[model samples]
Target chain A: EPEVTQTPSHQVTQMGQEVILRCVPISNHLYFYWYRQILGQKVEFLVSFYNNEISEKSEIFDDQFSVERPDGSNFTLKIRSTKLEDSAMYFCASTSYRAGNSPLHFGNGTRLTVT
Target chain B: LAKTTQPISMDSYEGQEVNITCSHNNIATNDYITWYQQFPSQGPRFIIQGYKTKVTNEVASLFIPADRKSSTLSLPRVSLSDTAVYYCLVGDDNTNAGKSTFGDGTTLTVKP
Candidate 1:
């Protein structure tokens, strides 16, 4: 089966540094999403991208966070300034159909660690 | 999005059938109930989804009552490898907009 792939399975960064997480969604998938989970917390939605524009975002996705479909296959999330609380497991997902009926395929996840 | 409530944890033995129930008292007409499973350090994987009645897939079965206020996920002949956290989510699947709210999932531990 095709998979959603994320780069840098683990990343370590200092506070105040900029970090970019990259994801390659499955080809033919139209919708892409980014979600994060703080250790021992529920997975939280960050943003969803469709047609090269942000379709929806959460309060957790603030001014410092942005997502771009840099290419046909690559979706990226950039954080201008990493805070200690920013450390968490970031997941990328894609689906061929809307989330209601078709299921979203998720990547293994990129573990972001901020010091 | 309707709020979902599921158990915090469950314990089962290998070969046993496991059922995890979720409640969504305020489910909407367009809302669909979906379940996802997550292992230790991985992203959530879809298990099954249903709007009403019973829906069965190769991995699990979803049972929704007439009221659609609650649903159940049933895993048959479970094994130790089945241990994982299962999340129940209620949302409108027709729109590409808005994010689904995920609550703390039920952690299932299958023992030998």
Candidate 2:
């Protein structure tokens, strides 16, 4: 089965530094999403992208955060100034509208560690 | 979408059936109940999804009450590898509703 692919399985960056997490969604998928989970916490929705534009976003996706689909296949989430609390496991998901119903396929995840 | 209530943790033995129930008293008409499993250091994986009645798949079965206020996830003859955090999410299946929020998941430990 085709799967979502995320680069940099693990990243350690200093606070206030800019970081960009990349994901290559399934070729035919149309929707993209980003979520994060702090240690011992529930997974939180960050943003959703469709039609090459942001369709929805949560409070966590503030001015410091941004998402872009620079290429047809590449989706990215960039944090301009990371804070210590920004440390978490970030996941990328993509979904297809084909067949009967759509199911989101998720990547292994990018573990962002801010020091 | 509606918030859900579930036990924080559960313990089961290998080869035993594991059932995790989630209560959502305020489920909306457009909402669908979905269950996901997450192992440590990995992304969550979809287990089962249902709007009503009983939906069964190779990995698990989902039972939804007629009232649609609650749902149960049943795993038949689970193994140690089934140990993971299980999340019950209430959301719309609409193509545009992609960012479904996850509640505090129930941690299941399947021991040998």
Candidate 3:
């Protein structure tokens, strides 16, 4: 079974630094999404991407956060300035179909740790 | 999107059946109930999804009542390795619908 893959399984950064998390979605999937989970907290939606553009985003996806599909297979989440609260497990997901019958497939998350 | 209410934790002995129930009092007409399992340090894995009645796969079972306001995830004869956090999410599955949010999952521990 093909699965979503994320790079830099663990990252450590200082506050105020920029961080880019990378994800390679399933080759044939069309929709992409990014979600984060603070330690001991619920997983929160960050942004959803489709057709090289952002389809939907949450309040947490503010001015400092952006997502780009730089290439056919690469979807990246960039945080302009990392805050301590930004430290969490970031997960990438993709799906061939959008909703109803098919559920999004998730990748093993990238643990982001900011000081 | 509907807010789901599931247990905070559950424990069962190896080889025992475990049922985790989730309540979504305000589930939408088009909303579906989906369950995911997450091991520590990894992302949540889709276990099963269902709309009504019962649906079963090789790993688990999902039972949704007629009202669609609640669902139950049943893990039969669980083993120690089955220990993980289980999240029940209610939403439409498409980008056109909305982004899905996972609530604080129920941590399930299967002991020997």
Q: Candidate 2 lDDT, tens digit per residue, B1-112?
A: 5789999999999999999999999988878888899999999998888989999999999999999999999999999999999989887755244666678889999999
Q: After best superposition, candidate 3 residue A29: deviation in angstroms?
A: 0.8
Instruction: Kindly list the per-residue Cα lDDT of model 2 for residues A25-94, writing each as its tens digit.
Output: 9999888999998988888889988897888889889999999999889999999999999999999998
Q: Model 1 segments beyond 4 Å from truth?
A: B94-98
The regions of model 3 sitting more than 4 angstroms off are: B93-98
lDDT of 3 at A45: 82
Query: What is the two-chain DockQ of model 1?
Result: 0.62
Indicate the TM-score of model 3.
Answer: 0.95
lDDT of 2: 0.88
Docking class of 2: acceptable
- Model 1, residue A65: what's the lDDT? 98
The numbered model that scores best in lDDT is 1
Candidate 1 residues B1-112, lDDT tens each? 7889999999999999999999999998998888999998899998898889999999999999999999999999999999999999888866552377779999999999
Docking class of 3: medium
For residues A33-75, could you state the per-residue lDDT of candidate 1 as single tens digits? 9999999999998999889999889899999999999878899
Per residue, candidate 3 scores C-alpha lDDT tens digits across B73-101 of 99999999999999998876442323766
Candidate ranking (DockQ, best to worst): 1, 3, 2
